[model samples]
Target: MLYSDSNSLVSFNPDTHTITVIRNNIRYDFEIDSTITQQELFLRGMYESRGYELSPIAKLDSILHINVIPFSSDTEFVSLKLDSLNNELDKFPKTHRKTTNMIPSKNYILGFVDGESLQVYYNFPLSIFMKKAWNNILTICIITLLFIFLMFCIVYLFKFMRNLSQYQEDTMNKIVHNWKTPLSSIKTMVELLQKKSISPTDEKGIEKTKFILEEVAHIQTGSQQIMRALIDAIHIQIDRNEFDLKKELITLIKEEKTAHSNQTISLDLQYLLPTTTIYASQFHLICAIRNLIDNAIKYGKDAPQITIICYQDKNNLMIEVKDDGPGIPKEKQKLIFNKYYQVVDKNSGQTRKGFGLGLNYVYNVIKLHNGRITINSTPGNGCTFTIKLKKWRTK
Candidate 1:
């Protein structure tokens, strides 16, 4: 005897070459042959197994017009009158290729009739058995890997396009700077020459010459900035530059302190840095320092106090410029370093006008050196700009 959770008992009858089932107080019997192929036996076993697990069992007896059961609920078992009786029900059934499916259908019909209460007795359809789960899991894994590959490709393409866009912007900026410088210089020189030809005793002529010299100096400063930007953009684009981390950031700190002797700020530079030299462009480093200094001078608040310090931290250089300024709002700190961004003095309420390019130049220079610069500021508190440059050595 074999029992399954589908509420059936199975037994074998060797004399009759049959399989028998007892389910819900009803008996079902199947007459199969010893001559049946092993494949057909296996298929029959599978259907019988499903019936025991999922539903009640029934034996199809084609010879009788009525379905046979031991006991069925009065609410469930009902007889449907046949409009025409076919003596065909008495014949032993013919087996077709599709007859394999009918075994489970026969079992389900028995289960439905035992449980359902209806006037009409309808045929029940068999459920399609789902294969094992591993195959489905494998298919899902394959599809997921394909989707990940596609996403990676899209990210790579976007990165490439962004780099291309940056290159074009750098080129345009350089060209515009170049064109503006020469014309500006020529205009200053022309103005100076004209001043010299004016009345000899006119003191205004001398002042005009001095003014022309200052104009030339300003243009020189601007030219240097543009050149630095162009070089940094090119080297960084090619990945040829790295941070030239210094162990003694204090060296520059002391020099800057001496340069701005009147400021009330104090210096504190302490973060461990490697003594090892980094491979970087010298021009870019100097420009980075210059931009920071320029920023400190322009924006330092009470008594224009600023402190410059540096030190080594692991494999990088940490240089900091802190100032007691009418601190930048938290929201504005990020925007301030962007190109063409400037914060006006709160007292003045007017947009402080310069090239609005200083901090932008600083950020680009630091980045080209494969470094990062960040701002720390709070309202009513001071601001500190920190530059971190990585350490690298040439093989």
Candidate 2:
């Protein structure tokens, strides 16, 4: 005969009068009466096994009732016992014998026949199986709640990133639109002044005014390029054309020198190639270069010296911008190109003042042109930024 619980299997052999139970990869055998019914095999095996112990009714303050009949055919040979109720065995009533039916007013009864054909009964106030089922239900509910919370966090993060991207695009639009009118007025004023007749001493003033106008023009061009780039989002669209790289570098250097005339900064250009022509987005490339130069001016030491070198190496054109500035630390070099990542001032223990978007923009522009940029610097020394691009030819 075989019987099963939620976690264990019990087998009983009437010829051998032995019971075997297997649970959690372990097996146990018990000796009992051959006449024990299959319905009571689990109870009989558990009671007879040395390792198995019965628990009292938890709801009834650890109370349990037991009744034993020495002979199945004779009710006269009976004995009774109560656990955790403080009553003598002899004083137990014979009329209160163990029955198969459980009474709601009394306790639940579980009975099994022993080896000598004796009936054993145990009364419990609650079922242990129901307690295990309730615990499993609670565990499932807790796991479900945790899954819901994680999904909500993921959704919220996605929406937050989308909103932030939209806000950035709107802000760029406003800035580009607002700067155009003033830049146009400055250009017109400079043109009008150049038309006026001036003495030889005022020639220097006219030249300075022209330089300021040129710088303002560069700013206007850069602003328009950035607006277009923002509209595309992530991928910058470039308008490629063949242009002289050497001429562009010279023009940018002159503009920076004029803009920061009061500062004792020197700008030098080195050309190692005979021709510096390339097919690229001239406006965006100029903006990227200007950002590097502006960063050097803002962060470099007193009377900073900046060098712009261009050369052709086989199939690639290389340009390097070197600055004699307070060098960047090794740890921060990789992170400097990330959007919104700023350098912290070691002396003041505060973040350096800037939007932290210049290097990110430069990186994107270079990527769109199928080029690469690298930084080489160490603390207390100078920094160098190298850009390599494929040389262009008429096809």
Candidate 3:
């Protein structure tokens, strides 16, 4: 942190194998640099000059609390450690210009010389980066769990379908067999991750790793809640009650609009539907509707527009959700409502990631209310999902 004569602030302790740097009149200790080679420094200089991505390893030395790492050789330099990182600073100037532009401008390089007179380049925030990594890992874990569950469902459905016909039995068995490899691979990968123990080399690493794992546990609880909802749908256990359909939808749309401020969402829309009361589980219906809206958001293009339509069609109350998103294929439409089925990315031939239960839960939840849901879509046009429920019920 010494703005003037910062070079004089650095010193080395051979006996302790550490480096000491005085910043803002406070003493900071870092381990002595021993591992980096000249070739790696050369590569580092080239990589930072052309690439925008920040380095994974955080540099230890800093001026005025801004981090800077060695981009030049150790032939002539000062060793520094402020917050436990042992790093070297090159006495040369060219490396500073190459590395500073790669990160956000919170860093300024004044005089050059391996981040010397001009200092601080790509000050990577390890904790923030670590959090992003943990979230991605957690998402992958939840998806793997869903894939496993769906695979089992396919096997179970195959068994049930076997009783229907011999042709279906063979076809279903082939599907189950075709699906096994990827499922096994995912399962094996997750198992390996679960069994392997991670050991952090320093106190900072240990703290960050512990924080990420703890966060993973918190998010896993949320995933479990979603799975619980899917399981409840499978069991067909929902409390039925009479609620004003139009009012419910108006509220739903209002909520959705708030949740997706960037996207356009509307209800009844151009014209409001007349008041219609229907006997059904409001909780289940709301969940189902939300699922459809979520699907629309994910599959929709940037700033996608969604509209909820409600009206009376004879004795049935009809509700429709329309999205200005990529339309579903005709062949994939039927499979969409099947348990554990997700639309494949036509371009990549990869199954799209989705909520754990997906449309299958919505389909079943609607069916439980003696209602039906249908999709009307054409590729490149957009998608519309309509739900029809009896206006009145006898319980």
Candidate 4:
């Protein structure tokens, strides 16, 4: 009593007096009669009592290979050659567009059935059973593909990281070799200087001593550069203490002026806040400020016009370092703060000297102090690095 729209082995012809069944292109007809049997009525009553309703979409793939015993017969079994019929069909598609799975699957329970169960089992087509069950086949396909792609990406990333680690180790080895020679020379010079005390009044000895001291200064500068690079490469730990922020900025400006005496430097300092005392690591904060100013000097073409703006906003102290220089490109702006990332100059096509860790160090130091730094720069307009810190109370 089931009807589906698609391909089916058995279908009905429009006739009230007869029932038509088609199997393998052959048709058979049976006359409808109102004959009643006591056992049939009993079985039908039991079937209806169980509330058994078969869906139209649920077609029988076929009966199982094993026999279905009828309660009416003691020695006879009704069987279907479903396994042999399935073997003659094409292989099941891995991800079939035409999704139809076998029904009563291999695990379906076998038992004796009444007349009603046998009628439907023999009449229904096996192909129709899978209509509803395989509906989500497309979704399954997409999810499976996505899972495979994710696994591929994870494997590629792991390989890349391993290669990067090896490269870093090799680079460090060469740097250490270069570092060891200069340190050895400095050590030897100090030993010799200690052994031979130059006479107090010898003019030639004094000039030689001055030359030795200048050479020692060069060695010290080299050592400092190496130390600074290492410091930037590691994590920053800040020791908090209260310090006058205004005083430190003045000292920073003066030191920059003294260091670059030949160049004309103009720093516009604006302090809008009446109170400047804040609790934080004074050394790292000043160093961060200095790095901003140093970057301004290093990248600026003309006499650098720098401005330091300090003010209070809500419960936070804000400092803005502005410079008149060739500004960063929109794309490279964020990348400038990444450790060991350097921006190649468009004009020179060469990156400026020193480890590219300066700005990265500045960012980490500010972050460690529970502060943040941001930048606003464009191709020709210059850069402004803004720092925000939570202003702690002195009292």
Query: Can you give the lDDT of residue 119 in candidate 2?
Result: 30
Model 2 off-target regions past 4 Å?
1-235, 349-351
Q: Least lDDT summed over 10 consecutive residues: which range in candidate 3?
A: 72-81
The top-ranked prediction according to TM-score is: 4
Q: 313-334 in candidate 2: lDDT tens per residue?
A: 8878788999988888998999
Q: How do all the candidates rank in terms of TM-score, highest first?
A: 4, 2, 3, 1
Pairs in clash, predicted candidate 4: 60-126, 61-126
lDDT of 3 at 234: 37
lDDT of 3 by residue, 1-395 (tens): 11123323544455665555664576666664456443333333323332344232222222222212232111122222122122333322323444433443333333333443323334455554555588898999999999999999999977665444344323323432333223334444443444464344456655655565566445544554545453544344455678876676666666555445435544335324555666877666876887788788777877777888777788777878898887989999988888767776769564655544668878987887778999999988889999998844543
Better of 3 and 4 by lDDT: 4
- Model 3 sits at a Cα RMSD from the real structure of 32.6
Question: Per-candidate TM vs. native?
Answer: 0.39, 0.44, 0.41, 0.45
Tens digit per residue, CA lDDT, model 1, 2-73: 223355565666677787766666777888997875344434543574453321112222111122212211
Best by lDDT: 2
Q: Encode model 4's per-residue lDDT on 259-318: one tens digit a residue.
A: 554479898789897787778777678778888998898888669999999998998888
Answer with 2 or 3, whichever has the higher lDDT: 2
Model 4: residues with Cα > 4 Å off, grouped in runs? 1-224
Instruction: Write down the RMSD of candidate 2 (Cα, Å).
Output: 18.0
Q: What ranking emerges by lDDT with the best candidate at the front?
A: 2, 4, 3, 1
Each model's C-alpha lDDT? 0.55, 0.66, 0.57, 0.61
Q: In candidate 2, how many clashes are counted?
A: 0
Worst 10 residues of 2 by lDDT: 59-68
